[model samples]
Target: MDAKTFKVEDTKNGTDHMLPMSDVLHALFLQRHNDTGEEQYVFRREGKKGHLVDVRDSVKKVRDKSDLSFTVHDLRRSFITCAEGLDISPYTLKKLLNHKATGDVTSGYLVITAERLRAAMQQITDAILQHAEIEKTTLIQRDNL
Candidate 1:
């Protein structure tokens, strides 16, 4: 991952997209990189893809431990709902989700930069963290590391 953005392979579209990272994400990714060293994939595992593809088992374990009922798609849906609630631009949200604006001519004309996406991502992340009752000071302290 770059300091501000990460490249993700969109399996649905068979394309790669660069998505901005929020400050919290940047910190977390930096820590992960440090722990894993220079690996081809950030979240590598002994899998067919050599990286985390299906998280169902992990999610199931978490669900069993915490008694939480949710799926991976639920998280995506929640993110989209949160982004929409935060009034992030439709195009930016689409880009964030790595969704192509098929049949939309207007979307083709818009150029959303990494910086812009970073700002949007930070905003959404902040809102989500705040709603989750995570203190801002805790995030600030993490960013310092």
Candidate 2:
């Protein structure tokens, strides 16, 4: 509806109980389950920054429920698709995805700042949750299928 926005405090956590991205990845890397005896996820503490988590695990649940197949990259692609389905433009998408429009490798190497990326991601997140305001139920929002 309104232009997507987020405040700096949007990501703030409590002083006593806080769960950062690093902590989640750390647990996913070295931690194993006691009952199921399976690792929750595969991650490395020293891996490249912003490298997406192994989404296969989450996608597997979707595949089983839907009786279909898909890949992790498909998830990212679907985000763009959902935005486009709402008539979001390619130029806007380039901004939303924090990608450079210039094709020249040398000249087009303009860096996408983290602030811009976060803002773009917030746009998608806000759009996805917008419909939650429609229904009269306890559900906050639905996940991508």
Candidate 3:
């Protein structure tokens, strides 16, 4: 990667708890390494490791949502499960996602068409959904972090 210009990472949603990519990848890679000894990437928690936050103190709490069931993290799990299908450039994913860092001044310097980026993201989304045995989710609805 060239250089990072963003201030705080993963605060795009104003979300109180944004899980780090490292934790997700570490657990995922561990799942792979358990079978094959070859190492992929080592994952470690990023800044402010486990700063205290409570589930009840969420930005938006879903009462009907299952406690042991689908919390917001499940959406993230679904994302990683999908992104892993191919080596997605994190930069591209970041740009495609309106994750505050969207205006990174690198590739973000260029004004990309929603259609083009949307297509690329859609392809990834389809591949990811397919990999997870999930049918595709439609694009008519606005998508974000």
Per residue, candidate 3 scores C-alpha lDDT tens digits across 84-103 of 55666565555444555544
RMSD (Å) per prediction: 3.2, 12.1, 16.9
TM-score of each: 0.84, 0.38, 0.37
Worst 10 residues of 3 by lDDT: 1-10
Task: Kindly list the per-residue Cα lDDT of model 1 for residues 1-145, writing each as its tens digit.
Answer: 6567788765678998888889888877877778677676767765444677766787898899889899978988989899899999999999888887999999989989888899989999998998998865586564544
Off by over 4 Å in 2: 1-54, 65-70, 84-102, 105-111, 131-145
- Report residue 135 deviation for candidate 2 (angstroms): 9.2
Q: What TM-score should be assigned to candidate 2?
A: 0.38
State the lDDT of candidate 2 residue by residue for 1-145, as single tens digits: 0122222222223222212222222232233223223433233222344323455665787899989887856766977876777665565566554355677564355565535554455455556546435321223222310
Tell me which of candidates 1 and 2 scores higher on TM-score. Answer: 1
- Clashing residue pair totals per candidate (backbone < 3 A): 0, 0, 1
Candidate 3 TM-score over all chains jointly = 0.37
Lowest summed lDDT across 10 adjacent residues in model 2 is found at 1-10
Report the lDDT of model 1 for residue 144.
44
Residue 132's lDDT in candidate 3: 59
